[model samples]
Target: MTTRAWVLHPDIQTNRDRKDPQPALEEAMALAHALPGLEVVGGEVVRLPKAHPGQLFGSGKLEELRQRLTDQEIGLVLIDGPVSPVQQRNLEKAWKTKLLDRTGLILEIFSDRARTREGVLQVEMAALSYQRTRLVRAWTHLERQRGGLGFVGGPGETQIEADRRAIDEQLTRLRRQLAKVVKTRELHRAARAKVPFPIIALVGYTNAGKSTLFNRLTGADVMAKDMLFATLDPTMRAVDLPSGRRVILSDTVGFISSLPTQLVAAFRATLEEVLAADLILHVRDISHDETEAQDADVRRILSDLGVDENTRVIEVWNKVDLLAEEEQLALIRQAERREDVVVVSALTGLGVEALLAEAEHTLDEVRMRKELILSFSSGKQRAWLYDQGVVEAEQQTDDGFVVTVNWTQGQARQFHEL
Candidate 1:
């Protein structure tokens, strides 16, 4: 049976930097809908002057919400912000329903969506870390005595302590396995690095239509849906631009505001493609009211992930099909006035050709000019440079030849290897 769930966004008035509560509540509802086997019956933004340390909600508010949840037969309550273990326990007991805070709910979604071996292991490790913190005394089972070997905790050890130890052990094992998986990924990256194609990464807020754009650009059938976090694993495909330039396009997991710290840390490897990208396309749901806020969140995450300040980025205003004709024209006009923005609608393939042409132009703009001297015996190297169409001018010299070439950083590196 599907679990009937209710969502709540605590709009704490004391937090001056809080996002607009209504949009935040709407996002929470979307997140609730993303998870399977859960029917979101209702959601609302609950106003509060401050949080109650033990229960999150005030007594009167808690009683009112409890009655409403009970009447609707809500079996799960999703709180749209951090909830301490004590607060979660107290709220669950008061409301007589299971509870999940933002971190827990996101973890659940990742656990369900993770498909690759590495992704599954990463989720398990993060979930264990989260579960470790929740091993409080409130759980009756944790109070039971555990018989332990003297090598570990002594006899009469509490089950909570034993459980924590077990989680630690599992974490250690997962770390070892993850190390192996990451090594394989690194090897794959090294191989790609030698392919002489610039990498272009697509990054954006969840459900911002990145996968749709990725499919449009590469003609690869990746899962593209209107649901939050529809794509979890990073996928890449080599695409040929109209200028005959081949580039690797990577579509990665989407970013969100107030993402769990555990997930951010754990998914760093998954997002390594973004770090290695020669150019980044920051896709945006231009029709959404909170698009600007979502853009800020994605940029903040890229910064937090140590993306270089000098890396080139282009803003892709996507989902223009969702807007009115006048709105789309206005966005197109605004984009035309900017050098680093492209207005597009991935769903209807609008402005995609222009996007590709712009990308080609941007890459061409980053090419560097270099001079190289080759000996008479380096005929193969000279031929390779000519084949790459990077040789601008060549002069025969006493040594052999002095060649001036215009190429990208990747091409320069490949020339050196040759």
Candidate 2:
């Protein structure tokens, strides 16, 4: 049966990291909707000067919320912020409903959406870690009234301890499995390295049209949806640019503001593709009200992942079709002033050709230094290298010339063929 859930964004005034409650609540509701079998009956932003240690809400406010939840028959309460285990248990008891904090809710959505073996293992490990912290002593039902036999932790091993141990074992097992999966992934990455194609990674906040743009550019049937986190697994496809250069395009998991710490640690292996990319396209939902905030969040995550400061990044202003014509024109004009920005609508295919051309041009500008030995009989090829303006230095030898050249990949390929 579908669970009826109510979303709550606790607007703690004294909290240092408080966001605009309205948008936060909206995002929370969207997150709830993204998960399966949860019908969000209603949602609201509850104002508070501070949080209650025991119940998270003030006494009277707690009763009022409880009454309303009872009236609406809400079986679950989704809090839009972190809730301690004590507060969660107390609130659930008082409100007569199940509760999930922001981290827990995101974990649930990830658990439902994970498709690949590595993704599943990562989610499972994160969920186990989260569950470990929630095993409070208040639940007497989990505590053994009598002593245990000597086989377990001798004598008085409480069920809570046993449960914790079990979770720990599962986590250890998952880590082993994840290590194997990661090694296999590393092997595949190594294989791709030999293909001589520049890897371009598309990264951005969730639902920022990275997958749509990937599909548009590569004609790959990757899942593209309006919902948040529609793409979780890293997908790669070789796209042939108009310049006849093949480059690998990688669509990775989208980032979000205040991403769960467990997920960050778990998915770092998956995001290695971004680290390996020759160029990064930072996609943004230009129409979102919090677009700037979202951009900051993505950049912050990238920095946390150790992306180099000198990494070449092109800002892609996506979803231009959602804007007014005047707004679109203004954005286009603004983008034209910046060399690193591209305004395109992945949905309508507008400016997609320009994006491809820009990508090719950017790749072509990346120069690689090479040393070539040309036979005396191959003077035509030697002249061709000089014609390309790539011959940096040359030394005469008995049978050939040893030439040092700094050239783009395209130039290098052309030289090798000659």
TM-score of each: 0.88, 0.87
**For model 2, what is the C-alpha lDDT against the true structure?**
0.90
Deviation in angstroms for 246 in model 1? 0.9
lDDT of each: 0.90, 0.90
Worst 10 residues of 2 by lDDT: 138-147
On residues 1-418, what C-alpha lDDT tens digit does candidate 1 reach at each position? Answer: 8999999999998887787999999999999999999999999999999999989889999999999999999999999999999998889889889999999999999999999999999999999989999987743453487655668755566777778899999999999999999999988976776566888999999999999999999989999988999999999999999988899999999999999998998999999888878789999999999999999899999999998777789999999998999998998899999889999999899989999988888888878898999999999899888777788999999989999998776566556766
The clash number for model 1 is: 0
Residues forming the 10-long window of minimal summed lDDT in candidate 1: 138-147
